[model samples]
Target: MRHLLVRLATVLAGVTVLAAPTAASVNLDVAGFGPAHHALAGHGVGYNINGYNWGGYAATGSGFTSVSATWTTPSATCNSRSDLYAPWVGLDGYGSSSVEQTGVATDCSSGRAVNEPWYEMYPAAPVYLSTSSYPVAAGNVIHASVTYAGGSSFTLTLTNQSRGWTYTTTKSLSGARRSSAEVIIESPPGRYPNFGTISFTGSTVNGSSLSSFNPVALDPSNGVYEAHTGALSGGNFSITYQHE
Candidate 1:
């Protein structure tokens, strides 16, 4: 795959808005998560860094060659078209400008829940799978991984174990830094849907437990949109929705 465009983002009133990266850019590309921007929102619990749209633990280190995690896709209760939630495992988005990640996204379409699996080399658009072949539904056991094979080549895999389907791709991105690993639930660019409680198991970086990297907890700090991040246990943790 070829992705050469970048998405520019701005924080206005604590709401992150992704707009054109450059005025001269030609494509009407969708915005994406670039690097992890840290700001301490005092109201958040264990306020390690302001995650903006990220709510999970990120293990930051250098030369992170692999990051993987498994989770059961949560059922999102939707009330509006703007509701969106994505649980993903990725590399570099926690501290670097590039994120090579893949997982499932639950979107509210016409006020109903719609789920699909996708891979992204951000700040590029997410590549939704061949919807016909890569069908994903709620409660599916999804395992995702982004592995640095060598040089500029990386492999991203998203598997739907409950449905017995796997999608894997290898792409070369020249500037990828492979800095940090993450297992995150992101609101992306909309109102986060009610995903109840979702947990991640077997979280690992470079084939080791994610907690071994001194994982930092981020709360996303979005008022009622904030969530409760459970304590990490042997590379496993949970994020329960907290709407107040």
Candidate 2:
């Protein structure tokens, strides 16, 4: 399979407005968690907001004041069956420096729902894969891969503790192209702790592809396992649950 790296640009800016002195200034901040960090590995990630607006506006003691805000959505796609490419943990702090709120997501596409298992049904769950039965040793990374099997693509997820994780576009199987959907998980603070095995669950897309999930017991030999959709060659996806 060919690997690719795509960067979604995130922008942050501030603006001022004129309003009554008694009016309060509102601040906003947005953060996305999940597959968005990696999009070339069939992760199908994206970002968005609903039910509310994000960002802040201020008044400068003017007779009339107005405040406006906007955001950019990452380039992404998901099949009802194939995979999901957005943050399950969504966004927060729409109009305040510090507030607690959930992020929003768009529905999946038609083709992906038919072939991929993750989005086959509505309201999909998070897919997890076990890196090892035990905590991965320091300075070590876990790896894996997936291939197109004559049908629509699928979704895959993994967990790790490396600071920077990425995919390559120069490598892949003979006939299939690397997907623009990918995700990278980073390690926690302090020393790398052993997070148990990674597992996967499936969600259906409304009018897209078919998604399936296979549960695997922990692998003891390589401390790594491959997703059923493809194989792990040369350990392409690698990360150690470690700290800087």
Candidate 3:
């Protein structure tokens, strides 16, 4: 069962699709720690690196010795970077991080599945899609935004791949629209910086439809905002963009 769970976790976490090469270098800093408007504590730059999403985090010890950490995938492409981006210390006040995964598709008929990435957070913060519950069902588009009081404005659009599902409006920074994206059951690899899904109906470079689907797992046990935790907190996150 242990091995089975590991496989399940690997499949659910979407670890198989992170083998692509990255387009740029990821840099993580630890000296300039920022404040916590998002609570949870952790901050830094976030983006895709070498086809794998990474987030860096660093925290000062009570007395001395500070701890700096980088959240990344177990793939060779990500683990073997020389200029690997490290986590950094956050500055005072509010801060934010955002990463985008584009060009997603799936060819189910051929039994070939491509990972469709989505941002997710652990500890499950109750999300609402247009005044409804979480997991904005299919056929609805939700406009999502995040702000850190004194921090920057973070926004993204979510389209439900499924139908008749919606998140509540009260959960949105701008109660007017909910996050929208076509939600698929294909769980992509990588970590969830925040909990949620972004639907994609586009074709890949080879002309394949996006069919990855996931039921949306809310992991509350893991609270530290690591790159793979699907939760966003205070941490240094990196992203190396790629197109193939």
TM-scores across all candidates? 0.85, 0.19, 0.22
Each model's lDDT: 0.74, 0.18, 0.21
Ranking by lDDT: 1, 3, 2
Model 2 vs. true fold: TM: 0.19
Which RMSD does model 1 reach against the true structure?
A: 4.6
**Per-model tally of clashing residue pairs:** 0, 70, 79
Given candidate 1, what's the lDDT at residue 130?
66
Best by TM-score: 1
Candidate of highest lDDT: 1
Per-residue accuracy of model 2 over 122-161 as CA lDDT, tens digit each = 1112222122322222232322222222332322221222
Tell me the lDDT of candidate 2.
0.18
- Residue-level lDDT of model 3, residues 159-244, one tens digit each, is 33343332211111222111111111111233232222222222111111111211111211113222322322222122222211
Better of 2 and 3 by lDDT: 3
